[model samples]
Target: MKLLDSGFRRNDNKLFFLTFYDIASPKTGGNMAGKKKGRKISGKKAGLSPGSLVYVGSRTDEPVRISIMDYDADRIDEIPEATLDDIKKCMARDSVTWVNVSGIHDTAIVEAVGRLYHLHPLALEDIVNTRHRAKLDDYENHLFLVLKMVIQEPETIRIVFEHVCLVIGPDYLISFQEREGDVFGPVRERLRKTKGRIRKSGPDYLGYALMDMIVDHYYEVLDQLGEEIEAIQEEALSNPTAKMRRAIHDARRQVVVLRKTIWPLREIVAGLLRGESKLFQDGTMIFLQDVYDHVVQVIDTVETYRDLLTGAMETYMSSVSNKMNETMKVLTIMATLFIPLTFLAGVYGMNFKYMPELEWRYAYPSFWGIVLVVFLAMLLWFKNKNWL
Candidate 1:
């Protein structure tokens, strides 16, 4: 049950490191433990109201980090960390403002941001509950998007699942994450350089960029998984041990979880493409469509991996069975060769008063000679029959 490796990249400040549980790693309490954690999280809100703000995830004491990027065609302001006053000033500007919250374990941070943006209480509730699935909810004034961002280590194939929520308004977009590091670094760089149409676009287009970055990273994860699947398949065909079978099953379960986590984003993206919310502009629908295509490709890759795992399991079982059959065939041939020898010895072993062969001078040597001849004859017959 030793884990593959830790895939997360720790920050230099070392404020806090996020813990990512893999469905494939047994040492990290695979699917059953995930279920128990889910139940425990649900119990925390058993008696609470629907809109009650409760952090339903791993508890941490680290302070939440808030960063902002306010940009228009001409100028862009980047704040590594912003205070509420700074956020207020950014809100006053007539530009696309992006507020990124690094952690959501604190209900107060979410509550404060909710109040500033006039977000629905239910939306705030979903934001704090980190286990929510990928979805889209429209609240007339803005759109709420929940997504699971998958991060995989290139060398170890270790995967981390992070919860991402986006609340897109007319001129601003607020994003909430469970931890500090993200794939959004590229999107932030693009914003800083004023690259492409992102600088001239609205919040909807920026939202698309963030989601697109996440979806594109899925290819990297899938590539790692693809190599792992090939390795497992080779091991199953060659070794076919008990441990290999477990690896195959664990891999299949991982693929299932990946499929479930990513499948919903397709509908969410398609909803945006169909103009389900006014927050998404018509100019951004084409880009959203591209994101939708990426989601489909990710889904297809996941499906293909699932099938490959199934075939690996079958191959493992077949290899094991064929091995057993060979062992049983050799044992049967050995027993068949001994049958005549045993009968001859039994006949001579009878307590006869005067047995001709028992009294012979060379009886024992001749008996061994006959036994060797019979053994060689049977072996030759078996070889000819191709059962050897």
Candidate 2:
């Protein structure tokens, strides 16, 4: 697996490039392999205590890119690859600031941003740990959210599941992502064009916009997965092979992983709908409700894929079984047709003096005639029975 490219950009500008981690391309036509050192498969920090600042993600030389956008109805100021001082200045502003952190491989930068924003230790911990569960934390001052931002692998029917952590504060929206592609590009485009109410709304709406972009993209992924499932189903019914079987299993596994990562997000958004955090303004509740609805749709599509994979697997098994049955039926017919021939041969093969058939003049030809007749009779019977 490898990430060819990913980052936040405006005006067609290249925001950042990931040089260290590239788990975007799956070698085996499925999700990223668990053994890939780039994804920080769990158990790396077994003895480390909670809130440890170690970055439990890919060891990437790609610098942590921070793009800050401070916007209001009056004006908007965008900073590309903002430094610590710039981030400090952004936090001091009264405008709705969106600080997009592209890579979290450097715990130092993440720690600095957390300290500047006064984020909770646990939130900071979750930011660097890619394996953290999808969850939400309301710490009175701000709301921390951990969720998966799914992106599709190009030219392949697979998904790139990247962990995104966010601290939705009253004045700012800070997003932390593993070294992966940009899923929040649309949000930046919206803010840049001032196309929607995002500019007029507060950071709550910005957070909603971010989540909406991610949730809406789920449909695109689902569409691709649906096509893959259909193709697998057709192949399973027609030309089922071991490769097709593995594909169905891989598809099912991807669906299960998707469900596990996305199910908690529904709860997280529902928590916002219930007004669990004060950071979410009343106006934001409707948007959150819409997001919740999209999440439900995504989950439903995932379940449908799961069912399709299950049916395809059964269909493949049934195909193989029918094929085996046909083979065995032919073999059984051949063996049955040869039984009498074998008996006749055995009688003639014996050297007993009382063997009358061996002494007959037409016995050899007669034996062949009987054998041919028995073979044709069995074939005709099998054809009549529709078992041939």
Candidate 3:
């Protein structure tokens, strides 16, 4: 991993190390940054000047990987790991140049790329922060886009998001990701096989394809959440437990996060469709419209899921309350039935010497008969009142 010597003094390096150490520390609930379970706080840059290139995210040991894909209608050149010279060569050509940087922990790569492409310092800063939500910033020569690549953990409804930034220029598109994996495999495949209009399109179209894939993956996440809701619903009705209640809450949280991440995307795509930025071409507007529609659908689905989970949570609470009420009713009825029996026993146990009951042998039996009659009358009354 190449380090940015100029960007980090010795003290700055220590500060960076201490910040990441805090992120990796095992302390629990020291002071929650937010409600997120394992999110890294962006407070590392709190006191820093604007456009400082501090990596405020999960750290990694893997070396930075830069891949290049330069293509046009005739042919394509693919570089698995591109050097600076290779990037420059690709950028000089008339073909569409795509430079994909897989890791951003090393500020050198970001700095070098920024110098090469004349990217704004603020844009580069946001690229490494990893906590910014989806947004768009149009510069004089390029359009900067921040998007989240979301994935649900296996066999669980937990959603993980990776920050991605795309800089779309006239002939080149530079992408920066927090990690190496992405949903751009299909787009890569299309470019390789010359399958469609992608090879003939500009970098904006490529950006659209990448964004579209991310949006499409939201459908899969929604499907998983939908299944989780159904299971929670069934369990809630049958037997609501504390664990099940927690599951409902967790699912609701996931939906909320998904909604917040995806909601702003609609506005971003709509802005592109409205020709707010000249980076997007007229030909790309239709495709951006499609993406906008998909965003709308995803937002609608998220809303529906949010409402469903809320309803599920309500149903779980209601079921629990009903069970409690039922138990209390049964206990109340039993207590009511014992009230008269206790009263008669108390009345007969008095130690008065001239008590009339002590003079008769049948006093005890008469008392027992009176108790049975009272109990039976109360029981009958309860049955008639439908309170049994």
Candidate 4:
């Protein structure tokens, strides 16, 4: 784990978005910082004191990038790596301001952002700890939200997971993402074009837009898993193997993870709707209700996939058991057919000098005839009983 001691440097990739009262905005190119290897998010913060500002994510040499978007209804200005004064100025504006920070690996910059916004220390702690679950917190001045963004990686259908935290203030919005990606393309495009109500709405609407993008991506991720579950189910029906069981387990695990991510978000949204948070307006609540409904739909889909995977696993086990039983039955029938034949051979092999049957000239031939008849009769009986 990298200690928070090397000083903070902004990464190359920074996303800045701002929406003002005038609403017109222009797009600016922002570089995405490359990924780097680091320690596990959960274990990195172990043995540390409470409220420690240690970053608990993979170590990335890429400096934390901060992009600021200052916009109003008339026009929008884009700034990459804006100084502290710029952020404060944007916050003071009556128009909505969105400051997006791409990397949270640097504690100093995160702490600086927190201090500028007067965010609680615990909220900063949660922001640094990537393993934290989806939650919502109200600190009078602003609303803090944590949620998971699950996206499928390209080329391979593997699920890529990241934790995002959003802090919603009176007229400013801040988003912290673990890494750089185009997951927010739709929202960014909306910001650039100013086509929809996102530009016409307040900061709460912008926060909702960001969260909505994250939630919308869940369906795409779930769709991929759904396809996998179908493939595994087909394999289980046709030619089942140990691999199908493993696939079922893996699919179920993914569903479980998605379920965990989506379930909490439902509660968070519902709580916000029910709780008196002045940050959210009546119009925003309507949008939030829609988000909650979407969450329910995603959760339902995940649970359905989970059940299907379980059924596929059960079918595979039953198929293997039936195959084994049929094999044993065939072997048992063969042994039973040999029982009478073995008895006859054993009686004839008894070397008795006074045995009349053994002395008969045609005894060997007659014995063979009897053995043949017995064999045919037993086979006929087996066939009649439908046991063959």
> Which numbered prediction scores highest in lDDT against the true structure?
1
The candidate 2 region of ten consecutive residues with least summed lDDT is: 9-18
Alpha-carbon local distance difference test for all models:
0.79, 0.76, 0.77, 0.75
Best to worst by TM-score, what's the order? Answer: 1, 2, 4, 3
**Candidate no. 4 TM-score:** 0.85
User: Global CA lDDT of candidate 3, please?
Assistant: 0.77
RMSD of each: 6.6, 7.1, 10.0, 9.4
> lDDT tens string, model 1, 1-388?
1122222222342211112352121112111111111211456788888899988775555578899999999899999889888899999999999999978888898899999999999999999887788899999999999998877543333576767899999999999987666778778878887556999999999999999988987897778677667877887888888877767777776777779888999989988887867888888998888899899999999999999989999999999999999889889888898999999889888999988998899999999999899989988998999888
Residue 157, model 2, lDDT: 36
Put down candidate 3 lDDT per residue, 70-109, tens digits, no spaces.
9999999999989999998887798999999988889989
Question: How close is every model to the real structure, measured as TM-score?
Answer: 0.89, 0.86, 0.84, 0.85
TM-score of candidate 2 against the unseen true structure: 0.86
Residue-by-residue lDDT tens digits, candidate 2, 57-159 = 5655666688889999878999986898998887677788988887887888888999998888888988887767899899889999988777665544345
Tens digit of per-residue lDDT, candidate 4, span 179-227: 7653677777678778468877888999888888888988886775666
- Candidate 4 error regions (>4 Å): 1-34, 41-50, 351-368
Question: What's the residue-level lDDT of 64 in candidate 3?
Answer: 84
Worst-scoring 10-residue span by lDDT in model 1? 26-35
Clash totals, every prediction: 0, 2, 0, 16
